[model samples]
Target: MVADFDTIDININVGPQHPSTHGVFRMVLTVDGELVRDLDAVVGYLHRGAEKLLENQDYRQGIGIQDRTEYLAQFPAEQSYVMAAEKLGGFVVPERAEYVRVICVELNRIASHFMFMGAYGTDVGVFGTSFIYGFRERERVYRFFEELTGERMMYSYFRVGGLAWEVMDGFEEKARALLQELKRGINDINGLLTRNEIFIARTRHVGEISAERAIEYGLSGPVLRSTGVRWDVRKDEPYSVYDRFDFDVPVGEFGDCYDRYMVRLEEMRQAVRIVEQALDQMPKSGPIMPEKMPRMLRLPAGEVYVPVESARGEYGVYLVSRGGNHPWRCRVKSPCFTNLQALREMTVGEYVADSVVILGSIDLVLSEVDR
Candidate 1:
């Protein structure tokens, strides 16, 4: 029994402007009726020569560039960039500074995931309710960030050897209170979408990728974890003070859109745990920066690469020094760009509408992809 029709495949260009494309991204989709036969993703429309630009900026000034490169999770970007310099210079970060860095970055991870849940809710057709719920909690974190760092979004708070300055007064009280609030917020978001039949129908088993394929594409963060891969850089490749924290790395079995959503939801809870521990273990009083630091930082001739587990995935910085205040070459390893590579593999053979779901699940920041 064969039923064949002479249907012509039509090409549709989605974005560089389309709202669902997530950023200034363009993808040419070859469609046969409602099915996606092929997808050609077009990036670089938002490119700003971030790496080349980093070469021109000094170590201190470059924190701002890292903020923009992964704006959604600026702390990780700033952390990676600064740690590279610290490594090359053999600088020691005080214990208090390490704990503070962990706390702030973990909170940033929660905020970034909240942003994803908000936007991904819209993509899954839950629209305003999830968007509002997600942002409500995100705003709370942002307000705290503004108070501590003096900048809401791109807080270049991290410096070469340590923090630019010690944290604000009542840092522990505020951070612990914020963690409690985030716990309740995570529960709220969970209740909103976790059991919703429509949400599950839309996301469950849609855009499925096998664990092996996910690793093959160099996927990381929630995307790779969703595929049942126990490969979190925080746990497997202990950076910062992550080795001291005991938080579970969430993974999913099906490796579908639903798994991605669930992984991020659970990750938020784990972030809260890490923050609480960091607050408890942090030194009561200490210097944020090391003593006897030179006015100008000039590293010996060498190269070093430092990677941190960002909200997205592995945010790494490769620094090449020639004994100067500025690096000879600065390279950023962006997880979004690498994760986006699997979009075509995930989209082809799925419904055209599911393409939006697939891309949304990636939770990419255009700046990271274009950086």
Candidate 2:
């Protein structure tokens, strides 16, 4: 038996300025009542020609450009660029520098996850509590960053073979205290949001994707982890001092928005553990940068690619050197750009409101996408 119902056509432009879009992103949607029939994500409102401009700048100056490409995860952006140059120039980073790199990068990863948790919660009507809580904790971490690097957000602290500056006195103690505070704060936030019936109702079982589909669509980070894959560049392909650190890669049972959220939470805990270990074993005195790194770096004529685990996913840098101070070509493999591809699949049959919620769960920064 079938019941006849009236059908109505509706078309809407969700945003070029919606908060849930995470930036100036527009989505065209065709709907029948509350259900979305079709949607198209319109991007490129934030493009800044970063990759094209890198070819004209020296290796050292080009890092500032990478900072703009993924503003949220600036350390990893600089790391990827420097790693590419290190591989091409055959420079060996000192052991101390490697550990410092790992520590800084992991801390930034925790900060980035906090942002996702906060912003995603707001997008789904959980109010601004999560955002407020997240930023409160994020500020402590950023203070540590400012103490060490002299910049709050875009820190150009990572150089060719080492850091631009050493960790200040009392930095280890501050890091230790912050890690403890973060552990406690994470527990509080988890209890507040992870088990809430309303929160689960909004996120659980939504935007489901299998591990196969995630890989096919080039998804990474929590999006891939949500699909039950334990693949992480830090664990599988060791970089910096990641091989020496003890940590776990959190994987989810189902590929849903809730699972992604949980994976990121667990990952933040793991990052805290790694940071504690680095603090315990940190070298007290050493040169932050390599002794022999040339002021004007010139690489052998060749191309090399270096992949690093950023907060979002595996960010890779492709560099072509023509035996000059400037690179002949540069290309950044931004995770947000590829991760956004799965959005259509995630939102196709869901309600209009769920579209924004699912998009936030994926956590794509427009700068990274537009780069």
Candidate 3:
């Protein structure tokens, strides 16, 4: 005979839908009343076989695939891909081009974080106000990018030796103007939710993870930094001209959803700091692409891995060449995919309602996760 009070845990499904799950992500949750006992994250719904596609494309052609793979943070993906080719080919990027690359990538980081703030606010139930605040600044940044690359999103502007072409006229002036607008946007988001009691109560201590646990889970970007790990690829690894600029890597003490939010909030300020420095240091005139460039690019037989600090985390690309126009093998170390591994850990033991908040804290781009 069974005890009268005994009850079995119930399974609840969240997403595979656009709005509820953030991007075609589905999680099966085991719940006992309002508390979650366990979770199983379902991915690969948005997989587009980016690695397989890269094999058939030449170094330059593969840039588009990189853009699609990490759609939200396209420049870093493009940078990693091109850097890998540059590594194998031994092409020297111009000083001016390097500075420009730094400026563009940093601005993209801010825009990507703005995206997080908007979506995160909605996940936390702040609704349209937060979303509007985020997109308002983000769209401004996008318009600036569109003016430069002629495409708001899928910008394959970064090339193997340098950029596809020189930046448009008055690039510096427009970027400076955009930075001032972004500062106000960041402040708006901070005012809207940072001190709000409802926001704090919902996020402060919920989904807490230890630094050790985070490292063990292989988390990176904001998710890892939230747990008080003060590591950033731009700072620690110091790729490109990042070593020339000065900026602090933000970290959190509690490793909760709130800490993750704060870390990204501070990062926007740091990004603006880096861009201002780059503008002052950039060369006035120089070749964007290396001279003596062959009409066709064929990397020597070798293997190389280049990692760049994307908005999400370390976006690394491993490329192998067999002395050909096309790469023999291409693999991406997407931070989103690695970070998603720990979602179950963060979600379990929290309230069922908090699952959405926890998942949003990871700030996932499912295409990257599924790539």
Candidate 4:
């Protein structure tokens, strides 16, 4: 016989389809009154086993598959895989190609952050404000991407050695104009959300985590920065011509939902700055792909790990080559997987409704987590 507590118990299923869960994620919540006593995130409803699938496909073909893993941050996924292959294969990317990759990845970061902001706002009951603002800014970035890669979402633009496509004529000018408008829109969004008293009250002290705890949980990007750690893979690791750019890694004093939200908001501004600098300093001419780029890329027998500062955080890809076109083994270290581990720690003792806000603040993609 089990001893039952005097307090009432209630069980709630958050979702396999909840808007706040974000992409086929479900959570089983055990609550007493409004307080969440125990929480379990049930994932794998979206698992496609991308790593296993990649082992059977050619290197070029695998890039397209990686795009679907984290659909919102497709550029970084592709970038991480491509960089891994390049390192393993000893391919040298031209200066122009590196600059182009930087611009694309940073722009994608803004788009990903926009999606997070919109979803997070809805989670907190600020219905339409974040949605309108986020997608409004996202449209400009998508337009630029559509023009360059001809695909808005699943862009397999990044290849093993360089890029699949080159920058089109007048692309620089269009990118500049789009980024300028985006900067203004970011300011307007900050004024609308960050300064609002209600927004602050809802998130300021909620889902609080210390810098020590964040590091212990292997947190990165805005989540870690929100705890006042100024670590960024782009700056610290310096891959794909990021070292040439001048930008600040924004940090927050409090590690709360609001702090994470604000840190990402500021990160968009920094991304815009880096994009502008990349556009100005980009080389005039070079081969987008290597001169001897093979149609079937076969790497020497070895392993390499590449990490990129994705919109989410440190997105890493580890590849093992067996002197063949297909990788012997491939692994993706998705940030969402590690970040989601911190959820129960953040959510316990908070209200059930606040769990949604907490999840939104973490900004996990179920595909990435389950992969």
Candidate 5:
């Protein structure tokens, strides 16, 4: 016998400002008592017309805008933008510069996953403890970034030819220390939420989607991996010096919320491994950029798409240059936007409370979503 839900169904608006939505995101939920019957993910409140803005800026300056899109993992974003520009200009990055870029990007990936751990812990009610522990490791990484890039956040340190400048002296030693500290931090966070009965009960078997469905929906990063797909842009497509590193790609089974959490945790450890290898192999000294680059980079007419593995997922930039100083069109394929498409499927039939945890499990940065 089918119970008529129409009599009890009610619509509730859940964001544009709700703390749990993670950003200025909103969703209108049609609920049958405590369960979500349907959901409409409302986006664009945070949109700043990122692609259009990129079209206007010169190639060198587009990186600043890219950082704002995925504020959590700026290095990968910068890498995609610069690599696209480099592809268009026929530029070759030096071997030493490639090694430094890899180390910078891998460290950035770990910091980004730390953010996911802290924020997701709050979604599961472990709040302050996870936030503090996560930030402790993230701060250490950021301090190292500040030493190299001169800014804590939106450091536009990557260039079309290579990097802004050579990395700081004693970079190898500092990198080794960062890895050791991060490993300890990871274990601490693991102890806090990985085995907690409350967290496990709330997250396990919740927000599950199969590997086939995840691929159908264009999911990537830990979200896709949680479904047991071992696809990682770094491994499959090998950007920068990723091909040289020896690290494992973490995948999950069941694609549940718990799997997503666990996958990200394991991925952090792998990122640390990659960073250690990079530091060891990196040449002690070399030019960060190619010799005597142009004051104003003017590119020949061409179009190129450069894809990089960001902490979020596949961060790609498609560049079209028509014999101009600025790109004729610059399009960014943001992972958050692609993954958010599955929100309705994940939320339906789940309790209203579980919806928040599921959203957090996706680990979004909304600026990227609405970009």
Candidate 6:
């Protein structure tokens, strides 16, 4: 009844700039009818040689470029770069600054996840409704960031020792109000998609990666956790003042597209908890930077890597200092790149259209992946 396996196999190229591939990404698919037999992802179209650029600039000047790599969650990228430099320079951030950084980063995490939710829904054919809901909350958060750092999206607010600037009065009140609004917005999203029959049918069993295989592939963030691994860089590594906060890492059991979606959904609630705790515990008075800061920060010769729990996964920075104002070398271990490696593995047995849905579940930022 069925044709010979070789007779139906056909090769198709997806995209290096199409919308569904999520940003300047290409994939070569070997398919038999609609079923994908193989997949090869091509990344780097968004590459701008970010690591080489960082090596050429002064430590302070590199923050702007770090933003370009992860436009959605620039605060964490800034944090990773600055924290690495701080370790080399022996700098201490003020108590207030640490609290501020955590709050801002968590808010940015919420924003990034919103971007994923919107995009993922579209991939599943919900079209503009989910995207509209997602951007509504994101725009609200972006407005707050604009007031705080003077940039809505690409904020270089984190500095080598602390924050770029201090918060204005009434900051706590404003953040609390935002938190309340976020709770309602998340509830609306859950009601719309969590139990939707079509959504479940399309995603429940698609793109499964076993826990062992996920770990073998070196995956992190929701993609890895969707396989039931309870690893989180924040809880396990406890960088910055994350240890002071009480939060739970959400894990998934199915290792499927639906589980990945649910994991990030629950993670948003955890982020809200972290932000609330930070506001309650943050000190009111302290200098953000160390006393009498030097005009130019020169680091001692050394190498250090700082790993932070970014919205996507373990976004890490490796810095090599040469006792100069500029770093000898800088490398970003982007979670998108590591996670994207598992794409072919996830898509091999799925339908071609489902391949797009699986890619959306990974929530990649191509600039970071290609960098």
CA lDDT for candidate 2? 0.88
* Candidate 3 lDDT over residue span 151-172, tens digit each: 9999989998999988999999
Instruction: Give per-model TM-scores.
Output: 0.98, 0.97, 0.98, 0.97, 0.98, 0.98
Higher-TM-score candidate among 4 and 5? Answer: 5
Collision pairs in model 6 = none
How many clashes show up per model? Answer: 0, 0, 0, 0, 0, 0
Model 2 C-alpha lDDT per residue in residues 90-135, reported as the tens digit of each score: 8888777877888889889988888888898898777999889888
For model 4, the local distance difference test gives: 0.89
Whole-model Cα lDDT per candidate? 0.92, 0.88, 0.92, 0.89, 0.91, 0.91
Residue 53 CA displacement from its true place in model 2, Å: 1.4
Q: What is the full ranking by lDDT, best candidate first?
A: 3, 1, 6, 5, 4, 2
Q: Please tell me which model should have the higher TM-score, number 1 or number 5.
A: 1
How well is each residue in 1-371 modelled by candidate 4, as lDDT tens digits?
22375777788998899767888999899998889999998889988888899999999999998899888899999999999999988999989999898889889999889888877788888898888988898888888898899998888999999998878899788888888888888887888788888788789889989999999999887888999999999999898898888999999897999999989998998999999999999987878888988888889999998989888889999999988999999999999898888888899989888999899999898888887
Give the CA lDDT, 0 to 100, for residue 16 in model 6: 86
TM-score of 3: 0.98
Q: Tell how far residue 68 is off in model 2, in angstroms.
A: 1.3
The pairs that clash in candidate 2 are: none
Weakest 10 consecutive residues of candidate 2 by summed lDDT: 1-10
Candidate 4, poorest ten consecutive residues by summed lDDT: 1-10
Distance from true position, residue 78, model 3, in Å? Answer: 0.5
Any residue pairs clashing in model 1, and if so which?
none
